[model samples]
Target: MAYKISEDCISCGACESECPNQAISEGSSTYVINPDKCTECVGAHDSSKCAEVCPVDACQPDPARKETKEALLARYKKLHP
Candidate 1:
């Protein structure tokens, strides 16, 4: 599943550089995650780097964008290739 930035986000830009897919970007107030480009780091890392590095734990999976590992990997491949 793709991750979403929550209100807990401090707008510190901590997660912007960590996303392998470049899915995260600065929003009006907080960082936003592009669900179409997010892959939960399936092919880039064993786990989500944005989530791991988030100081406020604002990076969370979006249930609304639920996806399996295979699907995530496919997206990663598509993005990387």
Candidate 2:
């Protein structure tokens, strides 16, 4: 599943650079992840880099935008291919 930044985000900008796919961007009040671009770091890393670096643990899986590992890998391929 793709991860989404919650309101708990402090806008510290910690998660932005950690994202391997560059799927995250600054939103009106916080960072937002592009679901189409987010593969949960399936191809680029062992885990979700944004979640790994978020100090506030604001990065969480988007239930509404869930995907299987296979689907995530496919998305990663599409993004990097």
Candidate 3:
């Protein structure tokens, strides 16, 4: 599944740097995750690095974009390949 950053984000840039897929970026008000590029760190790490490093816990899975591990892995491969 792709992850998203909520309004709670402090725009600390911590999540941006930790994103292996370069999916997180500073939005007009907060950090935003590009769903197309976001693989939830499936190919890069065991967990979402953005959530791991976000100070305010603003990064979390997007319920609307929910996907299975196999689906995520497919996306990760498509992205990296």
Candidate 4:
């Protein structure tokens, strides 16, 4: 599933660099995750790197954009390949 930054984000930019798909970007008030580009690091990592490094645990899955592992892997290949 794609991840999103909550209001709890401190604007530290930690998740931006960690996103292998370049899906995370600075929003008006917080970091935003582009669901179309977010693969949850499926082919890149075992878990979400952004969530792992977020200082305030602001990175969390977007329940509205739920996705399966196979779907995420397909997205990863489409992006990387």
Clashes of each: 0, 0, 0, 0
Give per-residue CA lDDT, model 4, range 2-79, as digits (tens). Answer: 888899998999889888999999999998999999998999988899999999999999998989999999999999
lDDT by residue (1-81, candidate 3, tens digit) is 799999999889998889888888889999899998898899889988999998899999999998988888888898788
The global Cα lDDT (0 to 1) of model 1 is: 0.93
Among residues 3 or more apart in sequence or in different chains, the pairs in candidate 3 whose N, CA or C atoms overlap within 3 Å are: none
Off by over 4 Å in 2: none
RMSD of 4: 0.8
When summed lDDT is taken over every stretch of 10 residues in candidate 1, the lowest stretch is 61-70
For each candidate, the alpha-carbon lDDT, in order, equals 0.93, 0.91, 0.90, 0.92
TM-score on alpha carbons, each prediction: 0.96, 0.94, 0.94, 0.95
Q: Which pairs clash in model 4?
A: none
Local accuracy of candidate 2 as per-residue lDDT tens digits, 44-74: 8998899989999999999998799999999
Clashes of 2: 0
Error of 1 at 64 (Å): 1.1
Q: Which residue segments of model 1 deviate by more than 4 Å?
A: none
Better of 1 and 2 by TM-score: 1
Error of 2 at 10 (Å): 0.8
